[model samples]
Target: MVSIAIIGRPNVGKSTLFNRLVGKRLALVDDQPGVTRDRRPGEGRLMDLSFEIVDTAGLENAHSESLSGRMREQTEEAIRIADLSLFMVDVKSGITPEDQDFAEVARRAGGKIVLVANKAEARDSDIGYLDAYALGLGDPVAISAEHGEGMGDLRDALVEALGIEVFDRDAVASDEAIVDVPVPEDDDTPLPYDETKPLRMAIVGRPNAGKSTLVNRMLGEERMLTGPEAGITRDSISVEWEWRGRHFKIFDTAGLRRKARVQEKLEKLSVADALRALKFAEVVVIVLDVTIPFERQDLTIVDLIAREGRAPVIAFNKWDIAEDRQELAKELREKTERLLPQVRGIRTVMISGETGEGLDRLMKAVVDTHRTWNSRVTTAKLNQWLERTIAHHPPPAVSGRRVTIKFMTQVKTRPPTFMLSTTRPEAIGASYSRYIINGLRDSFDLKGVPIRLGLRKPRNPYAAKKKRSS
Candidate 1:
């Protein structure tokens, strides 16, 4: 497949164009320049043309050891590997010396380059668009990636540059057909493990918790920019990998800080992006610093995951340098149980993101937690267990009338929601509900995932007759 790299200096709307081509808001966009620091890849399509597209950081003039310099290296690498390069320029701002320098850099890379003049919708952008020709990269493809303008011309330019024969028309048609298939709404059965689908997992935690380092270790390369700086990652970056023949799409998200401390607009955007990743993820790995495990913010994050109905696996990171390993482990386990009784018996793995220690255990725990999250109990087994549980310690009476839960059925999985028909739904107190939930957890081996139990009163058949008689 043909791969295209989108590269430019800061605030050129490169990410906007990349998102437009990929047809998803996969990259973070902001008025702030240099918001993107890593190279992000996605499958892109324009009309019938399909190719792999890479969004790169803005080219900056910095020393090789600086962060901006590192970002430039990533962009250069993307240009080196891609079949083509989309050298984007901000037409509204006109061409600058930086643009001239980066144009030379792209040309030196020896790849087929397409100059894209973005933000062409602005009335004053005409001069800037004209100025793009001075860079000597051929006639620029004028486009407004933000407003979806001049896309047809861009497609024609790509075909002219790369040749139409490069794209697989049949494969693209098949993919479109597959996407048109509708999903069944009534299919509530537990989903069987399908090896063809990639498991979606998100690694999240407070700032500076080694989330990026952990992802780099897993990928066996420096795929993410990492250092002692807090909040190095601004976007929730997803990477595709295969572990033991199982496909996985791992998302490494930005660090989350306390709500009060998040005063910046960019930080809020990053936090919101991280939250979206958590919601869509099948399993979330909460990376906690081992030395100070289970802080208030950490607990809040875990609670948020539970409330979002996401399966969670706890990872105590930075274990390589810790002292008193056994004692620390014991204390952490106790804290996990006492502080997080909602997700009782949650799986916790001690890992070292820097050294690749305990990674297998963490992945296994994630898989197991996801399975448990999707698990369902048969109606017969659920009622039988309910009978035995109530027999042991029945529900307390309300207003001198016993509260009887007659039937129970699992409504859905993916957090495992259940419905219970009871004589009085509102009479069930918090303590009694906790009892039943704990019983269900222990009997069904449903641990580490949130279980939702809803109570409702059965409809009365004689309600109309009683009203008429009265």
Candidate 2:
């Protein structure tokens, strides 16, 4: 695949230009001088051309010990590996010496160049177009990357500079025939996707977080319809799909409600569906909107996932137009940790069904997390993990008798169900059960998913001795 790099000086709208080109905000953007430091690579399709685009760290002349200086080194390395380059300049700011220096670096690299003048919406690059000639990078293409002004010229320039082929303009258009995503095959099915296996996933969140959008995205095509018209999806619909060569029969559940106000029949059914889905799913994807990343409904979903003994993976959707994404992601992570401390390490993925952005990351995380859910500890290894866990913080005493959990064995794969044989299962409090499940979820990296441990009271240990004495 063709590799394109957008290299320019800091605050030159390089990231804004890159986001416009690749149709993804993979590179973090800010009004500050230097917000992005990582070389964020993203995959995209431009008309018929499929390419890997690298949004590199902006070029800078800061001191060697400074972060910006290290970023400059990374940007230069990315340019050296690129097949083509898009040199961006802020039309409003004019050309800084940094721009000239980076232009020379790109020039020395000898890669195909398409110089772009961003923020041309005001005067249409009046001064910037004239200043472009001094950079010695040929005619600069003028466009507003933020407002999407002059995209036609930008597209033409990309085609000319990168030799991008022109396909049938209607290639991906769905006005005629609908496009369907491939289904997961049976052999590729993990423990959660098999026909007999209940694929437990919880559709949860506060009111109107697009839990429905997630269900529809997974179902796709005909025979199923879902949307955001408050409680439209009344009942849990069990739909099946083949994801990446594995078979998954999933339940498109209803929007969950809080425990107090769940007096309505519909709300009760919806909550029940969500609870059932969590029990059935080998892996669950919690739906959360980027606008409201984590709310009370989100916390309730996590609690339900923990209660039902299922695996969960958070879907932070609607990232297409998220503002303050860096802060949003940070807040989202912290909120999930604080709210659902039981599953502190549950995986969270930022995605957008509207733009199909970050779907691959979501799928990969789902698959990887599923593996952890299906993970089994050998009788020896489990006892080892169990022994160490108990020794570190032993079970508390209840009614003057210290509860002794003798052994634990994983009896099931889906949801990783385990059996913990103890002296008195009835005496085991809810808080202590969580202690073990939480320990398993964390120690085993079974984050964001449910792990169930059934507590069965050990047969009366002294019964045989007392009977013999009688």
Task: Note the clash tally of each candidate.
Answer: 0, 19
52 Cα displacement, candidate 2 (Å): 42
Q: What value of lDDT does candidate 1 attain over all alpha carbons?
A: 0.89
lDDT of 2 by residue, 346-430 (tens): 8888987666677779877877776776665556667899999999988889888998889987676655677899988888888
Model 2, poorest ten-residue lDDT window? 173-182
Model 1, TM vs. native: 0.93
Evaluate all candidate structures by whole-model CA lDDT and list the values in order: 0.89, 0.69
Show the colliding residue pairs in model 1: none
Per-residue lDDT over 94-113 for candidate 1, one digit per residue giving the tens place of the 0 to 100 score: 99999999999999989999
Q: What lDDT is obtained when candidate 2 is compared to the true structure?
A: 0.69
CA shift at 406, candidate 1, in angstroms? 0.6
Please provide the root mean square deviation of candidate 2 (C-alpha atoms, Å): 19.0
User: Per-residue lDDT for 130 in model 2?
Assistant: 78
Per-candidate TM equals 0.93, 0.50
